[model samples]
Target: MSEEPPRRRTIRDVAKAAGVSISTASNALNGIGRTNPETREKVRRIAEQIGFRPNALARSLLTKRSHSIGIITNDTYGRLTLPMTAGVSEALVDHGVSAFLCATNNDPRLAQLHLEALLDKQVDGIIFTATRADLTPPIDLTRLAIPVVYAFAIGPPTAPTFIPDDAQGARLAVQHLLDRGYRRILHITGLEDYLAAQLRAETYRDLAGAELDVLFGEWTEEWGHEAVRLVMERGGDLPEAIFCGSDEIARGVIDALRDRGLKVPEDVAVVGFDNWRVIATQTRPPLTTIDMELKELGRRAGLAMLDLTRGLPVEPGITRLPCSLVVRRSCGA
Candidate 1:
């Protein structure tokens, strides 16, 4: 006689084995509906023993939750994600939620494509990191079925957002310089149109007043070098100190200052932002700067998503995280 095909195990099989009704078995397995604790455990154990794996697609049809979160950004996805992405991913995993990340390469079309893909995948929520001020969001972010949170910067159409308080960050750096008794401060920052760059420069101007000598340029070590050159070219009337928008710029400033036969701190105190660990402490005489806490920012974004999923309310509008000053040998502390 030909061997009979094996019978597929279903909720009926589990229910019979656990001495429960089919409805009770299904409820126990899905954690829906009410069932006695003992019966629920018994049904679950029977299903496990029978090697029964519920179809997730079918389950999703019954329950709208897909238990996934998507993150979309514009720019060098790798460089920008950095510590921020790791923080957000880690937090989501801890809650048994999966995360999807996509980069737009600063292209609006690519950004829109990624956004649509994530939406079609039925992600529970989305986090968008805007590239620039003019960039518009693909969806009516406020009308999406999923919750959306904006990070690092804002795009067109307001939504829940979080961004580094560059003004506060610069304030922290400037306060550090002042606390060390450095007046006549010079600032080397990124392009003036950049929100972060503009904020940092403005904050320094507000606090430093006439003492502030601002230099505009790209966020590169090259700019830092030229800033010092500008100081020297000003007929040897150098500022008492320097504040750089980035650690790279700070590095250039340090090189140029040393080349001019000047001593850091002892000659011109220097401070920068973005407490880039590799670039900061690794230097001969470590540099002082403001820490942006990008990773913490990512983690906060993840937590905000979680709150939204659970129907918890967050403070409406943009939220700013505090920045801390990291003192090193560069600034006379």
Candidate 2:
């Protein structure tokens, strides 16, 4: 058995209560037609007192714009996109814009469907994001009438793509070890094909020196352990420090070192990329890692899209925000 819904409050009721015509009530509630400030405030106060709720469809029809935006992503794991989405949402909420997320899960067809549905709903804008900064979104956003922004993922050539500066992030890590007076640095990182890995590795070589070795493997804890094994099999003293591509790998590095009766920071200082706090903070001595600031990237992306919708001047093309080091105990000072 379904229960009956409560009677909805309307403008006519609000007008009667405020002693004004229905037309005047609508104008005051909508902030249009230059209504007298005192009268407008009185109408609004009465409207609130009676719990009056304006119709969204009616408001949109009058405003010619929807106050909602869509977020489309294929980040199967929320690790990267969640914080990014939070940032964008925070920025949009202040501007009276609401965001709804549509997860594509790497399915191209589903992504297209989501995009179409958002368009049908008359969303003011859309944001495309993903787990990888370099991977293109599964959907093609060609010639869409509404404003769109890319964050934590790559988009079209001319699209405003916001991502962390991976090269700088890598440089910051390697330089941290160097500044701590460690010259014999070792680099262990994720797959070679990932742009993030490539950029970080390239910068590591530049800052850690070309002669120092870099071990490329999966972005996993097992790979970190294996990397340590390989280093030991070479039959030499371990490097003064190791710079890993991710916090997961860093944890494995720390664990493997412990198994070999080695002390972190005391035996070998270790640093990692991605301040993934779940793993980073849980590490034995905690992890000193680079933060990509995905939220800040998302915030910027949100603001940029709003500016675009308003026909404001927004710089086009890719925008790489800076990543900073989140200090922890693993690196000793």
Q: Please tell me which predicted candidate would have the highest lDDT against the true structure.
A: 2
Clashing pairs in 2: none
User: lDDT, candidate 2, residue 273?
Assistant: 90
Candidate 1 at residue 233, lDDT? Answer: 79
TM-score on alpha carbons, each prediction: 0.82, 0.92
User: What's the true lDDT of residue 226 in model 2?
Assistant: 94
TM-score of 1: 0.82
Q: Candidate 1 at 32: error in angstroms?
A: 4.0
Name model 2 segments beyond 4 Å from true. 1-6, 16-21, 36-46
The superposed Cα distance between candidate 2 and the true structure at residue 284, in angstroms, equals 0.6
Per-residue accuracy of model 2 over 51-111 as CA lDDT, tens digit each: 9998999999987888899999997688888999899988898767888899999999999
